[model samples]
Target: MKQDSFSGRATQGSFFEGLFVRSLQASGPFAEELRACGYDPHHPKAIYPIEVWNAALEVAWRRCYTGWTREAAYREMGRQLALGFLQTWMGKVVDMGLTMLGPDRLMARIPSLLALDTFRYELKVQPLGPHQYRVSIRNDPDAKPELIAGLLEAGLGRTGVKPTATVVMHREQDFDIDVTW
Candidate 1:
């Protein structure tokens, strides 16, 4: 498995597979299918989200459960889960005067985590209170406000990067962000 792509750090395979497999091990509808199919929950390859697991299972069924044929399925599972992690738990929005950290660096840290080679993003910073400011992200220019909020929540979390004193707004073309450095 690969990790820290930009920095060229290798990550353990167990960490990659553990994300989803751990969920299934907790017990659910998906586990029953895997058991019926004779798949090993303890196997390193079984460590992906239920959705990705289902996709692989479909391909596995078509190929008659051949272990050698699962490589593509596993890769696909990695892509999906990687995207989820990137969009969910990375980046922080700080006050404008906090050491000049900008949008590109923030986006780079995130998209790179997913092994995404290319992506498009836009960020806007506006001054508000005496020591407060707003940093709005229009990730997709065509996306509506609701979508932006969803992205913000995923990329920066509902409470956002500062976490101490911040406001997150989701509105198309006109969103509000409050922050105090």
Candidate 2:
């Protein structure tokens, strides 16, 4: 038998921000779906399985993004989550004096950050140039490739990188994202 995309683990900080802080932006029906999935945005747990996060992402994508494609919606959700993360105490701690590293260096450190904040979906960033990078994600993949792309964009934007762009080549077992700023 085959497992689904939800067969992994997710962090309370990063993944929940994608749903509660960024996607839903309100209290109501979506809250019930999250509750049914064993998550309550009002009182969240420390870590949730990827299935719960995926459920929350689905509710957000369907509810908050009416006119957008699934991938686009997820990408925006990812972006919002990144932006939201920037405003948190942890984000402040992570960003404390780290901005001097600039976007490229920060991009390379994504693997460690993912390990800390996410349980599933691993990303490896390989620099192709001073301002260009090849990002590949393995393990249990969730959402579209653009979701991570959006995250990179948002993170890069904070580092004073002008015009961060991520182009997804295609969707295989992993996501190949070409990021440049």
Candidate 3:
């Protein structure tokens, strides 16, 4: 028999739990937004795919905290959670390439998705050395420095599976990001 690793178990939890905690009501504003974007709310379960959900995870990580200090790291977690939740929804909204609606309308919504408050932030990748990258971010001014860096390290290290990205946050903005992709 094969052994189930801790990382594998955690990933499973992130997805399954994320589905319920991440699902948008089919009868609420979210559903309407989906329809407007070419998604069928009545058949949401069938329309949304696992790949889209996975993509949400990708977007969320990018919005996570980063800083030269620890405080910034902890504060960024909150932003990450909030942004991740919304991206997960939008990813589901257009995951099927707007099959339920016209592609032009779908294309029009692309800017809207990018406009989703959570994704309004920017991320820049700078090569530190050869295989190393330095990720710097500009986020909420009230955020602490130490915690932000720690969180960036933890989040990126886990996401990239190489434990190698260095992150930093600037204490003068509301944007958060991951320097390592």
How far off is residue 49 in model 2, in Å? 1.0
Write candidate 2's Cα lDDT for 6-83 as tens digits. Answer: 545555645575447554564788777667766676775567666666666787787789889988987887788777
Q: List TM-scores for all candidates, in order.
A: 0.28, 0.83, 0.29
Candidate 1: tens digits of C-alpha lDDT, residues 22-91: 3113135445455444334445441333333343345333443246344333333333333343332231
Sliding window of 10 residues with minimal summed lDDT for model 3 = 1-10
Candidate 1 pairs with clashing backbones: 20-48, 145-172
Shift of residue 1 alpha carbon in model 1, Å = 22
Better of 1 and 2 by lDDT: 2
Give Cα-based local distance difference scores for all models.
0.37, 0.68, 0.35
Native-structure RMSD, model 1? 13.1
- What total of clashing residue pairs does each candidate reach? 2, 0, 19
Runs of candidate 3 exceeding 4 Å displacement: 1-122, 138-160, 164-166, 174-181
Q: lDDT by residue for model 3 over 1-181, one digit each (tens)?
A: 1122222211222222223234322345544444443334354432333334333333333333222233443444433432333346443443344345432233234334322122234434445544445444444323333333443343333223343222334556533333333
Q: Model 2: residues >4 Å from true position, as ranges?
A: 1-8, 22-24, 115-122
Cα lDDT of candidate 3 equals: 0.35
Model 1 TM-score on a 0 to 1 scale: 0.28
